[model samples]
Target: MTRITAVWTARDDLAAMLAALNVDGDQCRYVGGAVRDALLGIEAADIDIATRLHPEEVMARLETAGLRTVPTGLAHGTVTAVLPNGPVEITTLRRDVATDGRHAEVAFTDDWREDAARRDFTINALFADPATLEVTDYFGGLADLDARLVRFIGDAGARILEDHLRILRYFRFHARFGGAADADALAACTTHADRLKALSRERIARELLLLLGSADPLAAAQLMADCGIWRVILPETAPDGLAQLEILLAREGQTGALPEALLRLAALLPTDPLLADTVAARLRLSKTQRLALGRYATPWPTSGTARQIAAEVQPADSVAPWLLLRAPDAMVSEGLKSLEGWQAPQFPLGGRDILALGVHAGPAVAKVLGEIRQRWIAEDFPEADRVRQIASEVAQSAG
Candidate 1:
């Protein structure tokens, strides 16, 4: 038997936990993304541990060892062990008892093979015992990770039926892995496309956004569309719209991608309030994001020289120029133009100023005050003399 060793040299934390687990001299390793990413030479963010000990046993031993334990997902046989290094998520090996394409009923067992079978993909199913730093590969996860391929543990269609979200996950993992999607898996995803509608809008929106914000979003999106998953996920999008989206994606291809959901939506659907409102409501976007989407659907001055536009229209000085440029309407810029550095000159020309200028304080004062403010924005607030000149013209017109 070939022994598998973890690529990372440092993991005293894993050793401590293994001792606490009563594994004594037995193997416990850091598994999943950390091990896979280490092998791939990418930075791993979180460390996950899969132990041969059952959930209840692991919890008892950790608590006995004086470690704070949180049953983050006890139903699924997972516990969070907060240690000095970091919070390590330790889950008992389990197999799915039942799945409704949305949620699952799991049964915990001591068999690592059963646990590996429950994972979404082969690359993710790998585990390492952190203490001795030995990797346990039950499904050839190490080889798949080396090939940069994402394959289901057993059958693709079966996996999709078990969790509809996996459809989106497939695309997201493919984009992140920077690898071509498997042809058979892609076909299975297409066959089960309608199951995606069973997923919540929030889940679909989140996964789709994550996929879009990836390095090769266009490729992932194109794959989704070709596989028939895009139609099920975003029923409103049309082929012509996707073409336009491809152009936008290419424009944003270099780096620092912003997942402007509204801008992306606009490329497919017309600037219609119904479309924008429906998407915002379904996706439950933040107030700021919703407002940005609404602005995109409305009419705005998108064409013309930058100088003709108001300087305030650019952004709040704190906002990105790309965001302002992507806004549906140029109202942001228009608002800036109106509010620029000019703000009615403190109304040194107010109702009081107007009455002192021999103007009555009735509706006439209001009219004169309004006129002065407009003049300020139009003439760039020349001075109080210019304000008074405009005020008098308004009082004369009213007379």
Candidate 2:
């Protein structure tokens, strides 16, 4: 048994919580993703535990040990114990009584094997004793972990039928963990591709973004497209810009910057404003994300002139130039790259400045100020003296 020596085990708060909950190390054990990630030498975010004790018993024992307990999901036999380090979730062992492709009705059990069998994947079913550091694998999760295989715990089709979201999860896990899709798992996902439509739009969108943000999502994304999964969720779009995505990712890597999710998402979309709006509304994207999508869809100026590029650029929409630079035209791409150092210069003159120049505070004054600003931009943002001269000329003519 490979012992996990992650920093989580050495935390004093965790040791206190474990000592408080364990009554000889047979009743409670750390389980699920935390165990799996620890074994793989990855930093686990959330620590979860499974125990034979009932929810009420777990609460009583923790409170007696002077630990704060929250009934996060009592109906599901789960309780959260708050410690100084962080909150650790403790759930009673459970076996599925019934499932409806989306939710499961579970019965609390004391059998560890039953709990392990009820999980989705073999890698996620392993358990570790917090006190003894003993990892118990009912399934062959250790071997699967060693091989970097993301196989379903039991029958792939049966597990997926229990919850169709697992189809997306199958690809998501592959993208993050570095593995080829399990043959049976991929086949199950392909057969159930249409079932993804039955899922809530928010759920589908969330899963899709996470999958896209993974370390290497190209293969998983292509697989999703090939299996018709993309058609069900994003029927209007396809993985057509994968080559552009590869280029963008490589460039981002060279700069040592994290890849932006929205940029990657844009690679999958068609440059049509109406279609972008529809997709944004369908996914219920936030206002900022919608605006970025809008910028991507709006056509950019084809002229490679500095004035033309400056006219199209806005401070809030700076990412637009980067997205447009990926265009097939070499001249257009070069023009955008040249404007990398260009900042939206503050207009030296304002409406008030025009009004003070003997111009009345009305639409005429506003028009003069606008004209002066345009002149400044057209001249590649000349010095303050040139801007003042232009503003004065416009103000005098309007007055």
Candidate 3:
């Protein structure tokens, strides 16, 4: 008899919604991720409800109780009851009638076991009574959860065949929850890796990014590559840079900064600007993300002094990728720390300043300004007076 008592379950809004739906002893319970996360002592991000009542009845009861209801997924027997805390998706128990690997045709059911059997994994199929904190495990989800194993509810291949996206979801879940891949599950994922092409690029990108964003995605990423799953989705990339990722994660932890998903993704890529362009196009990353990745992929100078290169690269975003690529290098680490308060020195001479120096307003003035700026940067940006004197000399020579 496993029980979960968590803030999500004890919320008054949730209790009220459950009470409204459970009028006359109608069964409704918290299901899926909420139950699993609560039992694991992680704060549940969303609360989903499975009910014996049909979708219409669930909607009618909630509406009559003065709670807002949205027919968010009515065709799939789901309705959302919006509460102050967050939206609670109330869905009638369902069994799959047909599945074409991408979409499913489901039939509503009253039997909880039927619904549990159709779920992707055993650990995600557990249900908990909102009122009594009692959990119903038709399958051995509790045992699997205790062992930190993510196994399919029944046949691994059959479950994956129902929705190929579950293949990535399998790895994503393992990354967050800390589990080794079930043998059968890994085999099924590898066999059906090609089916991932049928999924929309947006869908594939979303799942892959989520996997990459997990607490420790390196192991799952390596497994995906070894099994050809990585090739199916992102053949141009490799997991060879995972060691750099570990270092970047450690640095982020030390600084108390939120982990940047794009940075982690960049760590997995080769330092080739062309590959970054291809990946950005393939993943349809946002404009900002693409720019960051493009800068990250730019090759750092291997020959220059650290300070010289650091002065050349001013934007923190530009320097961050190089530092991450060369993480734990004492020189690179020191350069990164030095950049904390450093601002790029402004060029002392502009086109107007050149003009004031008797240099005619033309390409020669621009050329002389450029040369003086180069000297300034090379000299590590000397005092403004010295730079101005140097600029004046260059401008006079050009004139």
Clash totals in order? 9, 0, 0
Better of 1 and 2 by TM-score: 2
Expressed as tens digits, the lDDT of each residue in 1-399 for candidate 2 is 677768898889887777777765588888989999998888998999999999999899889889999999998999999999889999999999998887889999999999999888888899988877789998899888888888998899999988888989888888887476688988899999888877888887788888888877888877877787878888877456666566656655644446566667766777676887888889888877777776666655554454445554653444434444244444444554655665566667767778778887778887887888877877888889998898888877775
Model 3 weakest lDDT span, ten residues long: 324-333
Judged by lDDT against the true structure, how good is candidate 1?
A: 0.69
TM-score of each: 0.76, 0.87, 0.87
RMSD for each of the candidates: 5.4, 3.3, 3.1
Model 2, global lDDT: 0.79
Instruction: Give lDDT tens digits, candidate 1, residues 140-238.
Output: 877777777888778999999999999899898888884767887898999999999888888888887777666556677778888988678777775
Ranking by TM-score: 2, 3, 1
Backbone clashes in model 3, listed as residue pairs: none
User: Residues 1-399, candidate 3, lDDT per residue (tens digit)?
Assistant: 779978777679888888898888848988999999999999988889999999999988999999999999989998999999899898999999999889999999999999999999989999988767889998899989988898888898899889989989999998887576788888888888999888877788789888878877878877787678877887767556766677767776765545667777777778787898889888888777777787777776665545556666645456655665544465555666666666676666678888888887778887988888778877777999989889878877775
Candidate closest to the true structure, highest lDDT:
3
